[model samples]
Target: MAAEISSDLLARFAAIVGAKYAISDINDQQPYLKEWRDRYHGRTPLVLLPGSVEEVSAILKLADETGTSIVPQGGNTGLVGGQVPHATGNELLVSLKRLDKVRAADPDSNTLDVEAGVTLQRVQEAADGVGRFFPLSLPSEGSCTIGGNIGTNAGGTGVIAYGNTRDLILGLEVVLPGGRIWHGMRHLRKDNTGYDLRNLFIGAEGTLGIVTAAVVKIFPKPRSVGTAFIGVDSPADALNLLHEARANGGGTVTAFELMPRLGIDFVVRHVSDARDPIAEKYPWYVLLEVSTQSEEGVGDALEGMLMAAYEKGYAGDAVIASSLEQAADFWRLREQLSETQKFEGGSIKHDVSVPIRLVPAFLDKAIAAVEAFIPGCRPLPFGHLGDGNIHFNVSQPVGGDKKEFLAKWEATNEVVHAIVAEFHGSISAEHGIGQAKRALLPGVKDPVEMEMMRAIKATLDPKGIMNPGKVL
Candidate 1:
């Protein structure tokens, strides 16, 4: 049974978090309820924007005592319905947007102590100000919060080198259900302690608890950088170029992306400031980059790698950015690949990851499958090629009905995921399974793993009031 969030209960919430922050007005709560894809429209009787960890603890404590489910939300930029509430309006929404504060920046330790609501961009800027880099680069960095990133274990373009949010996290401070605060925010790199409680909440999607704050890893700012967009005949050829790039530059290979001709066309047509870096259109392309913390030879190394790939026939042609502005322009094409497709109509998207070597074959098989499923469908596969994570998206064909094309989302997902499973790839690569992939979880995840996850959830959140309908 759903706990009734009565007027008296709302009053109590207001008392705990303050009246102005406990927003009950439907108009004021729209942003908290809606999300990026416009798929999940949920209802919440009250939206609580707690400003402090103490306030969040108080809210969680009260909800646990009252048996009210809490949907802990960050910036609400999550693709899955993890950040959104259920349609029943039975759950209470808790927004951590007001918790936007960088508590400390320890340059010696190479770590930044930041609150959950701190936007990813702000954290980056703060790191830059201190002559350091927090390299969690993504399209949604401007709006996505680090807390939300932690919740989903987000992996952006930097995953080729720095790694996912989980890897970048040094420590965490979480607010468990029933209001107990777990202050495991140690900045130490070596902690051979018992079970890692910090990791439990890192990718839990709020089903476990609310991440109040985090201690994130930081690095010395790179001094030199190089960017290139290569024209390739096939995904196989792209992988070849990847090997060359890695052999020459190794760890300097920061972001390596596989973009299809269709994706490039979409970016050129839809995005105003962006243009095709490689003038001639090839069947496929790879937007790649290399960088070094030492300024002397990074650019020359990148140029030599690109030249070698071209000579080997792995690359048809390439464009090496002469200046930082041009490099940004090259990356602009990769960054807007996903958003530009919105102009094309409904898209059936998949965020899957396979073995580095199997990526080419995976793409070939998946592309053929989707095209066969729906003739005239445009298979736009593009993403972090270095990490083997591809955002393989299918755009509705010309003169196709938008609703009808979107209706095939589930079927298309199954088609692609079945092939993904054959190669031992992850179905939910970066996007955490909220409502969108909740049903698909049991089929994809191991039975033993599922049981273990259930046991943990049951143990920690015995009342099952923490984001009631999300994750497991």
Candidate 2:
């Protein structure tokens, strides 16, 4: 049970954080109480903006003593409503935006110790300043924080090379529910000391504890990057191109993204300054990237791969980016796809992943199922093909009522997820199971695995005071 906040408890919280940092007025707390996607809007008794880890610990300690629930929020750009609090207005919203800092960076060790509140874009800039690269690239990197990325184990275009946020983390600094801080900020390449605790909190979604800081791995900056926008006959051909690129590109393949013709048309029509690169449209398109340490012969290698693909009828048309501006332009077309789809009215989106070889079958079956539900519903299937994760999204039919279309969210999700289950794929790929997917967890998770997760939750959060009613 959640405890009600009294005037006395609010006064104590205000004393820990300054009076200005502690907000209780509904108007003052409006921004922090809502989520980025506008899907979750809640009421909170108090919003606490702690400036330091010590302040966070003190606040958590006070909340623990008072039996008050605490909800941790970072950047507030999460898609699944994980960073928002419940609607009951009983939990205390703890915003870590003030704790943004880069504690240290050692290029020799290829690691950087950064605070959780640091934005993903800022981390990338910091790494670039030190002549290194932080390869966690997401569409919302400008607004999403390192804490939320680590919490969700976010994957983006770089996953084909650098892996997910969990893979990039070498150590962490977390504050547990009882207000005790765990300082495990080591940058060792190999530390075989018992079980790995750092991996535990990477995708926990702030259920077990709050991530205060982290020591993340970095890589040497690539001297050259080759980008291409290719038109493929189908998703199967895109996969074939990916395999060929890996074999002939000599380990330089970094990203392989798939986009359907409808998705590209949406971006070109809705997104500003977006245009099609190819003279003619194809059923499916692929944006492939290769990064190398040597500047010479990288473009030649990419061209050679595409030429071979064309000879085998795998590629219909292709365009290799010749300059840095051209490369950015090619990526811009891919990155703006999600935003462009918003103008098409209500949409049902599923972020799922399957085995690499099963992607074609998954796409074929998912689209067929969706069409069976509502014909001509404009299926916009696109995402990281190399990782077998696709952002399978459905836009409302042209001239359809948005409310009536969105009313079938549950039905649409069932149709898509059933196909995903048939292929033995995950319903939630990079996004964590926040409040949005809490109800669906039991349906997909095995009975024994669900019990084990509950056991861990009970052990770490005995009082159930951390992010109540989220993820399990």
Candidate 3:
């Protein structure tokens, strides 16, 4: 239960962050209200931009006392509606962008302390500045913040080499519901203490608390790199190529992406200067990258692997990047796959993951099911094939009504998701279960596991003032 947000109550929240920091105007709050996908839009009475942990603490303390609902937002680039407030305009939106700061950087220990508001690109740049590498790369790295990454345990292209945000995080600084600061930002990697409390909030989706800062691990930068774009007959060949890549690189393969010809066509048609890496357009393509600490045999390894793959009929035409610029161009095509799909029309996207061996089967069945259900919908599937996550997106047919096509979103999801479940895959892989998939969680998750999650939420936030109606 939460209290009604009156003008005076809003004024009280504004006093903590000062008038300049408080955003009461509806127009100013619009940007924070909607998600990037434009699928979930919400309204809030006030949006607070707090500059310090103490300010965050004070806001939460007062919120707890007043029984006010608090929705924590970072970067506002989240696909899920977890960052957005309810349409009732009663919850308070606390934006962490002002808390941007690199508190510490130690290349010697290969770790850095960053506030929640620091963008992922800035973190990568900071790591590079310190002669290290932070491998949590994302397409929205320019705007997505550390807090949001931690909230969702975000997975990106580098997830195959480096794990998700949970694996990179050493510890997190969180503000509990009653404004109590949990100073758990320890940099030590081998602290086998009592309970592993650091992970409790990593993928909690802000239902338990607000993450204000984190100590994350950095890695040694690779001295040599090899990137390639290969044409494959189908997802099965792509999977076989992935097997050859791993066997050839032997722990050096960083990314193996699967992109359909339709996705590449969308990118080429919509994105300027986006050209196919291979002149011959195959049904499926793979963007493969491998890196090593030494510069000796990366190129030779990639060349030999492709040669073997060609002999086995796993790959058709291939182009290994000879220059860094060419490698970037190859990546640009893969990264722009989702962004350019909008030009095709309304897209129903699914971030699902299956076991690596079952990727081809899952895609085959899911694609067939969606096409049969929607008749003329374009199935554009692509993502990190090395790690088993696929961005299975379906674009509406030519001259189709966008609204009408989108209206079948739920029904279409049922068609695709049913196959995913048959394969023991996850419905929401990288993206957290925000409002979009909140209702679907119970059907997919174990009953006991769901109950345990609810008990933890109630234990941490008894009043349920933290991001209500979000992930249970």
- Candidate with maximal lDDT: 3
State candidate 1's TM-score. Answer: 0.98
Candidate 3, which segments miss by more than 4 Å at Cα? 1-3
Candidate 3, residue 377: lDDT? 89
- lDDT tens string, model 2, 235-330? 999989999999886447899999999989998998778889999889999999998999688889988989999999888789999898998988
Tell me model 1's lDDT, rounded to 2 decimals: 0.90
Q: lDDT of all the models against the reference? A: 0.90, 0.90, 0.92
lDDT of 1 at 202: 85
What is the overall TM-score of model 2 with all chains considered together?
0.98
User: Which 10 consecutive residues of model 2 have the lowest summed lDDT?
Assistant: 30-39
lDDT of 1 by residue, 1-472 (tens): 5966798988898888888898888998998888878899999999988989999999889988899999988889999899999989888899889999999999999999999999999999989978999999878898999999999999999999899999999889999999999998899999997988888998899999999999999999888877887899998999999889989952378888988899889988988888777678899988888878776787678778888888998888888889889988988888888888889998999989999899999988999999999999999988888999999899999989999999999999999999999999999889999988899899989999999999999999999999887889
Would you give me the overall lDDT of model 3? Answer: 0.92
Summarize candidate 3's per-residue lDDT along 319-384 as a digit string, tens digits: 999999999999999999999888888999999999989999998888888889988989999999
